[model samples]
Target chain A: AQSVTQLDSQVPVFEEAPVELRCNYSSSVSVYLFWYVQYPNQGLQLLLKYLSGSTLVKGINGFEAEFNKSQTSFHLRKPSVHISDTAEYFCAVSEWHSGAGSYQLTFGKGTKLSVIP
Target chain B: DAGVTQSPTHLIKTRGQQVTLRCSPKSGHDTVSWYQQALGQGPQFIFQYYEEEERQRGNFPDRFSGHQFPNYSSELNVNALLLGDSALYLCASSLRYYEQYFGPGTRLTVT
Candidate 1:
């Protein structure tokens, strides 16, 4: 089993400021990491995923996340944010194989990102 | 092609009543998974269906069950619903060993 922890429940940042949302996962086996964003009343959209590759992964809306194997972390960062970037972000993790005979993702509670003007 | 689609964007049900939500997967997708999202929380895995059989289940009780059709559509049925069931129910579609694509979800209100 794998679990995701997002340290920040809420993040408030000014427009055009850089921001980082921290995430950590616990899994003894190989894992896949993902970041998703949700606006009010909308379904989740995959921002980016770390299957296997370099530590840094770029996503839409100028967002990027770096996977740290040693730290068991995948933190999302952006040089600048727009007001429209305000939304809830979730960090997710999954084992390469689940005993239940399926590949399922376990998610963090969520972090609310509020962009202040 | 259309993405995953869920029916009855909004639903209201009284306690002890039953409710069924439907989902149509994205084209070319063969697996459908269900999740429950409470207010201010991330979505929780409910179950998954593949090839018209229940391929996986979560920690939820038996009151929460689902079915998958041969066409790869799915339905989540809740028996004797409770007020705690009020939340957003999301349906996601995926291929074998592929990342999931989620639908807008059905907002179920158990009054």
Candidate 2:
């Protein structure tokens, strides 16, 4: 089984400010990491995903995340954020479930990012 | 292409009643999965359907059932609904062995 932990429950940043939302995962085997954003009353949208590639992965809306295997972390970062960036972010981990013969995503509780002017 | 879509944007039901939610997979997608999202929480996987059969399931009760059609559409049926069942039901579509795309979800409120 795999579990994802989002260190912060909420992050508040001023417009044009940089922000980082930390995420950590625990899994026995290889994993895929992803970041998703959800606006109020809407479904989650994929921000970025790390299936297999370089350590750093860039995503939409100027967001990027680094897959640090040693630390078991995949933290999302953005150089600057706009007010519209305010939303709930989720960190997820997907791994092959041998018992089910399929991949399932385990998500973090979520981090609410609020951008202020 | 249209993304995964779910029907009945919102539904209200009473305890002990049964409810069914529908989903249409994205174009070119043959796999559909269902998830439950409670207020202020992340979505939890309920099950996945592929090739007109249930290929995977999560930790849910028997009261939760599903079916997949040849067209790759799907439905989630919940029996004996309880107040605790009030939540958002999300549908996701994906290609086998790939990432999933989600729908806006159907809000189900059980009174």
Count of backbone clashes for each model? 0, 0
TM-score of 2: 0.98
lDDT of each: 0.93, 0.94
Q: Which is the leading candidate under lDDT? A: 2
Candidate 1 Cα deviation (angstroms), residue A5: 0.6
DockQ by candidate, in order: 0.82, 0.81
lDDT of 1 by residue, B1-111 (tens): 999999989999999999999999999999999999999999999998988888778889999999999999999999999999999999999996678889999999999
The DockQ of predicted model 2 stands at 0.81
User: Candidate 2: misplaced stretches above 4 Å?
Assistant: none
After best superposition, candidate 1 residue A78: deviation in angstroms?
A: 0.6
Q: List the residue pairs that clash in candidate 2.
A: none
Clashing residue pairs in candidate 1 are none
